[model samples]
Target: MVFRFAKTLDPITLFHAPSLQTSTNALNILKAASAAATAGTVTSNRGEFQLEITTAPPTTDQLRNIIDYVTANPAGAGSNKTDYAVGEVIKGAKDAEDAVKRFKEGGEGTFIRPITVDWTNGKAVLGDNESEILKMVHQLEAN
Candidate 1:
C-alpha cells in the first residue's frame, strides 16, 4: 500500500509604500498651498494679512496656522479691526509665498494652486492671480 501527503502554501502579502509616499506628498502640497494663499497678502507699506480658516472650505490646520499667524501680528490694528480689508491682501501674498516654498521643497507631485482670493474686495487685485498660483503649482509638479 502507498500513501500520499498534501502540501500547504501561503499567499504573498503586498505593501503600499508608494501609496504612502504619494499621500505624504499630497499633504505636503496642501500645506504648501495654504502657505501660498497666505503669502499672497504681502504689500510694500501695509503688512501681511490673515484669513478665517473656519470660513474657507477644504483648509487644514496648517493653512489655518498661517491665518492665525497673520491675525496675531496685525499691522496697525491689533486684531480689533472690524473691516479687516487690508489684512486680506496681506494674507493673499503670504499664501502665495507658502505655496511657492512648498513647491520648491518638493510638493509639486500632488497639489494645485487655487484660482480665487479669499476676500470680497481688496487693493491687491491682480487678474488671474489664481491662474498664476496654479501655474507655479504645476511647474513644481512637473518637476
Candidate 2:
C-alpha cells in the first residue's frame, strides 16, 4: 500500500513596519484571517495557511523573487500581463537594480511596508488593501 503525503506549504508572509499605521492595520487583518483560516471559517479553495510577520526587510534574493512573482503573467489565453514595477515593492526605486542599490544604502527603511506575500501561490500585495490581500489568500487553485 502506498500512502501519499500532503505537500508542506510556505507560510503567507507579511513584511511589516510597526511604526507604520498601514502596516499595523495589515497585521490586524492578517491575524484575523489567519485565525479564520485555521478555524476553517475561510471559504477558500487554497485551504488553511500559516502567517509569518516580519519587521526586517527581505533579502536581495527574496526581493527579486517577489518582483518576479508580482510581475509574472498569469497562465492562460488572453490574460493581460501584470504592469507592476519594482518601485511598487521598494519605495522610490527606479528599477530592479535601483531597488537593490537603495536597499543596500538605506537598509530596512527602504522597503515598502504592509506588503503581503502568499509564497505558495506566488502572489503579493504591496499595500494594505484588505480586499486584494484577502483575494490572494482565497485564490482558487488552477486546474
Candidate 3:
C-alpha cells in the first residue's frame, strides 16, 4: 500500500507505516507545530508547511485521517472566529486541486517537493505542509 505523510513547516521527524499509529503520530506533530505557531514560536520564517508522502497522489482516506485529526485538535481553531473560518476553508478544499498538488510527487519514481501553507495575513492556506481542516467544520457551523 502506498502511504502518504503530511507535515508542517517545522523540521519534524515522521514514522512511515500503514497503521493508525503512524497517523496518530503525525497528527501529534501537527498539533505541536500548530500550538507553537499560535504561541509565536514557529513564525513565517517556516514559510507554510509541507506534507511528505510516498504516493504520487495521496489517497482520500490518508488525507481524511490528517484532516480529522486537525479538526479535533486545539491548534486548529481554539474558539477563534477568524481562525475557525480559515480552518473551514481548508477543510472544504481537502479534495481541491491545490490539495492534490500538495501530495508527494513520486511513487513509480522518487524525489518530491514539499507543500507550503500561507498563514500570513490571517489567510489560512493549506498545502503539502499544513491544511486547515477545522475551517470546514466552522463554516458548516456558521451556516
Best by lDDT: 2
TM-score order of candidates, top first? 2, 3, 1
RMSD of 1: 21.7
In the range 1-143, model 1's lDDT, one tens digit per residue, is 89877432111111112334432443344345545544763222222223221212223443333234323334654432222222342332345456445434543232322212323221111122333323333222211
Winner on TM-score between 1 and 3 is 3
In the range 31-103, model 3's lDDT, one tens digit per residue, is 5655655566644344334433332323544343334333334565554323222223232344434443443
Model 1: ten consecutive residues of lowest lDDT: 8-17
The Cα error of candidate 1 at residue 75, in Å, is 49
C-alpha TM-scores of all predictions: 0.19, 0.82, 0.23
User: How close to the true structure is residue 118 of candidate 1, measured as C-alpha lDDT?
Assistant: 28
Cα-based lDDT at residue 92, candidate 1:
29
Root-mean-square deviation of every model: 21.7, 3.4, 15.0
Query: Candidate 3, which segments miss by more than 4 Å at Cα?
Result: 1-19, 47-143
Backbone clashes in each candidate structure, one number apiece?
Answer: 26, 0, 14
Q: Model 1: runs farther than 4 Å from truth?
A: 1-19, 41-143
By the lDDT metric, which is better: model 1 or model 3? Answer: 3
lDDT of every predicted structure (CA atoms)? 0.31, 0.78, 0.34
